[model samples]
Target: MKVVKVNLAKNVAKVDIGGTQQWIRLDIVNEVPKIGDYVIVHAGFAIYRLDEKEAQETLSLFEEMLRHEAPLH
Candidate 1:
């Protein structure tokens, strides 16, 4: 996910998740993320920042897995 904006007072950030926007807490990350940074979000929190290579790899993996999965009715 890419960070779009941050709310320091709330300790949360607004991020783009595959084009969709969502808010995630920043408390879990080791370092604060600036806008345009890529992060790994889990359970409503930004767990860690991802380097460019790792981000691409992770995104590709997710796309591949999702493509083969059965869709919900």
Candidate 2:
């Protein structure tokens, strides 16, 4: 997931997950993330931050899975 925005007041961050945007709570994360940072979100919360390489790798894997599992048209 990519951090798009952060709501410090609410302790929630808006993230882009596989092109979809959603708000995730930051209470579970040890480190605060800024916009453009990649994070690992689970159960409506960010668990950890990902480096650029890891982020790209994860995104690629997701894209691959989507491409293979998408419904045939």
Candidate 3:
């Protein structure tokens, strides 16, 4: 999930995975993500937050990888 909406008081965040909203816990995150942050959720928890440039680059790489896989498979 990239986009995030956090309710820090409740220690939960609704993240946008594709177009759907999924809730993830912030208990294990150490430093919680802000409203506009980009994060990676693992096991229903926010584990990593990526900066804007990193998020863009990682997404670009994923898109490139998808394009490569589609033709080969």
Candidate 4:
């Protein structure tokens, strides 16, 4: 997912999960994240930040997996 917005005062961030907008807590992450940064989220918390190249590759893999699975549903 990609961080699209950050509310430092509130320790919250809005991230883009695929095409969906999700709000996650920034307090749990080791470092603060900024907009346009990719992050790893779990249980409504941003757990880690990811580099752009890695994030895009991961997203690509997920898209490929979904494409392969789409015919089943």
With candidate 4 superimposed using the best TM-score fit, by how many Å does residue 64's alpha carbon deviate from the native? 1.5
RMSD each, Å: 1.7, 2.4, 2.2, 1.8
The alpha-carbon deviation from the true structure for residue 3 of candidate 3, after best TM-score superposition, in angstroms, is 3.3
Model 1 alpha-carbon drift over 4 Å, by segment: 71-73
Clashes in candidate 1: how many? Answer: 0
Q: Candidate 1, residues 35-73: lDDT per residue as tens digits?
A: 988899899999999876888899999999999999798
- Per-residue lDDT over 1-73 for candidate 3, one digit per residue giving the tens place of the 0 to 100 score: 6656778789899888568889898887746788877887789988888877877888889889888785544
TM-score of 2: 0.79
Query: Which residue pairs collide in model 3, if any?
Result: none
Give lDDT tens digits, candidate 4, residues 1-73: 8999999999999999759998999877877888999998999999998889989999899889888884544
What candidate 4 gets wrong by more than 4 Å, as runs, is 70-73
Give, for candidate 3, the lowest lDDT window spanning 10 residues.
64-73
Where model 2 places Cα greater than 4 Å from the true spot, the runs are: 68-73
Candidate 2 has its poorest 10 consecutive residues by lDDT at 64-73
TM-scores of the candidates are 0.82, 0.79, 0.80, 0.84
| Residue 37, model 2, lDDT | 91
Can you write out model 2's per-residue Cα lDDT over 1-43, one digit (the tens) per residue?
9999999999999999658999999998969999999999889
